[model samples]
Target: MSAAVTPAARVERWFFPLLPNSRIAVLRAAIYLFVVVDVLVMVNDVVPKASAPAEFYTPVALARLIHLPAPQENVVLALRAALVIGALVAATNRLPRLLGWPIAVGHLIWVLYGMSYGKVDHDHLALVVALFVLPTVGRSHPHDHRADERAGWALRCIQLAVVATYTLSVWAKIRYGGWDWPSGATLMWAVERRGTFLGEHLVHVPELLVLAQWVTVAAELAAPLVLVLRGRALGLAVGFYLSFHLITYAAISIHFLPLVVCWLAFAPLEKIGQRLETRPVSLRRGHLARRAAAGQAVAVVGHEAVQPVPDPAERRDA
Candidate 1:
């Protein structure tokens, strides 16, 4: 007889779903790769910002609490070197705990160091949270698709962060911009300031920008629905958000690549890894089978050289 599941147990199950460790493995590699790219290309200003005047340095709250010093050129360079090298090594899935924890901590400080200069980008929320949680998954096999609660927990943390990015954006909009934010000329102002040619043209269509602002708010407000959506619905929801990011970038030249990368938490990326790992093995098997069919002599260890076995009909005739 089976015991009844308590409400707490059910909540636990939902929170720590038994997803495959392979998914974590794939997600880890992708995230670490993105970190290397991010430091090099997207947020490549840390070292340069170190060259800025000392008077301009204003540490964020966490930096202030920890008494972290303002970025120095030497320190920033060393941090960048360590972060890039560590991210590359960690992406290979070797010594996960040893490499991953430092990368996570180093990246947090790196972001703080960069944002200390005045401008702070919120797109990093999901990515930073992802780096911290990914280390908790430890080592996961690229070929092992077996369900693991630990991997699920780590992925759930990332997914939650992703959701929070959107939901919190709405809160900030309302809190800072007020209830009239959606109806206001916020999008129009952005278009007028930094928008691409497409965005500039789109703004001319009367009330279009206002409509877009409202739609953006409504979509973000419905962001929580992504957590509860399943199967095709979930895929569509993720797809929709991805499409939204692409469109946003196309129109405004602004992108959320960091947060976009973290969206892979909801994907079955384990399947991609599994398929890639098995492809070579499958090809080798096909090669051996083809050689055997041609009656080619094959050497067997601890046995004599042998020809392919005869078909059942051929054996009967003999």
Candidate 2:
């Protein structure tokens, strides 16, 4: 007779399967790389805030808890330097936990410091989640052949965070904007405020703007499908989600690097990491072809494993 299933086991089965370390390793690299790029590229505008008058530095709740100093030039520069260097070291998978934990703290401080000047964004949710979780995952070698539950846990959590970003975005719209948001001239309002070159001309088209508003809401509502999808379905859904972001960016000139990078959690990153860490593509393909020709079993596993090919001679004899 079997015993009753425990809550822990259920959670493990559903959320934390054994996976190759390569996946999390890739995720780790991607998240940290994005952290560096995000600071230098996407969030660089916030650096100027450090030089603003002390009167303008209104810290957020987290900043208050930590009793952060006023955003001065030296402080911001120090934080930026630490973040860039920490992220680069962390991406190398060297002293991961030691480097990772501090990077997370630094990045959080970085985000809070950026927000201290007034403007804030919800886009950092995924990046923040990745930063905190990566340190918990510990060491995950790229060429590992065995499954790792710890690696799976971290990747899945990142994936869930990615899904929640889109899910909650629409929820916010509905919560704050109510039902009229979709039909309303939301696009027109946005276009009038900070519209890019493309959006400026489109603002005159009332019908198109209205259509875009509804489409935006509908697309966001579909974001939760990433949680339940797998295989080709998940791939297609992610592709569409990315396309939607691109379209919106073209129209509004907004970028969500954190959210975009988080989507890597859904990718077959182990296989990708393997390819990236191995020889050139042509040489790697030749190696695999030779292996196949020698009647040896060859298979690749990612989000799911491909069926191993059987030797032709064995099949013929059977």
Candidate 3:
């Protein structure tokens, strides 16, 4: 009595599974909050770079295509303020498409302006993709756990972008450093330049660093496996990546926090909102139960006092 699924249907289902809208809501808030912090901390140089000479403003490819101008003091300041305000408003989930679209575009331009000088970071790829895709989901609420294809698609895009970020790193490494990248002194070189106290001590064990390099390359190459992994296997894979990032940061000061934030796409984030909404109700019920127990000696029935029926458990305890 069931309909058969076709190959195209299978592909569509893979790309767009039905996930809770609450996950989208949670992701939106987290991503927006990160944007606020990022503008202030990680990429704060946008306004400052406005003062840098026009000659140093070598626009990136996207900027050139969009005809984005060189950063000006007034323009950059306004863009920064707008970005912060837009992100704050969007986090509130009001007029999502209206605010989110501009925020995405503004963030792109903001990062483009920053990177134009030199040094384009790969970490923002997933985050930028998330910003664009999330808006397509329109409105989602933390308490709304309804399964939505929109939310699933958005999450899937972010997950793919995250996997691509890891997978592409391998490609880039192979392209630039050849097949022997894992056996090379790349990790050692990075440690020498920006290594922390831990990394400094780690340099003494050269073979361990080389082994770590091999593990990292192998892990990144296998990053796509996370998509097909289910249940505990999926959780373990995500944990492994998070642990790798943590260890990387401890060894060197570099932390791809933007990319790390996107990892929530893999989490059952709807539980957080659901628990928060239900906790107060559960507490109120408990409070009433305690009060009832305190006055269990008597009960009022039809405005007449009567002996209360004791619970079997209480009688057993007595």
Q: Point to the candidate with the largest lDDT.
A: 3
Q: Could you give candidate 2's per-residue lDDT for residues 1-318 as a string of tens digits? A: 999999999887768878788888888888889899978977786568877888999998889999988877887788889989999988888788999998998888888888887887878888898899888879876666468877878888888888888788899999989988988888888888888999989988989989888888887777777788889998999898888888788888777767988998888888976775566755756766677667666684453332446767769999
- Report the CA-based lDDT of candidate 3 relative to the real structure: 0.91
Q: Compared with the true structure, what per-residue lDDT tens digits does model 1 show for residues 1-318?
A: 999999999999989999999999889999999999889888899888889998889998988999988789998899899999999999988878999999999999899987888888889999999999888888887888899999999999999999999999999999999978998888878888889988989888849888888989999989889999999999999999999889788778889999999999999999997799879977766666666677665555333334575667777999
Candidate 1: count of backbone clashes, pairs at least 3 residues apart or interchain: 0
Between candidates 2 and 3, name the one with more favorable TM-score.
3
> Candidates 1 and 2: which is better by TM-score?
1
Candidate 3 lDDT, tens digit per residue, 205-276? 999999999999999999999999989999999999999999999998889999999999999999999999
Give the per-residue Cα lDDT of candidate 3 at 191. Answer: 95
CA lDDT scores, all candidates in order: 0.89, 0.83, 0.91
- Which sections of candidate 1 miss by over 4 Å? 292-295, 298-318
What are the TM-scores, per candidate, against the unseen true structure?
0.91, 0.82, 0.91
TM-score of 3: 0.91
State residue 287's C-alpha deviation in candidate 3, in Å: 2.7
- Candidate 3, residue 227: Cα displacement in angstroms equals 0.7
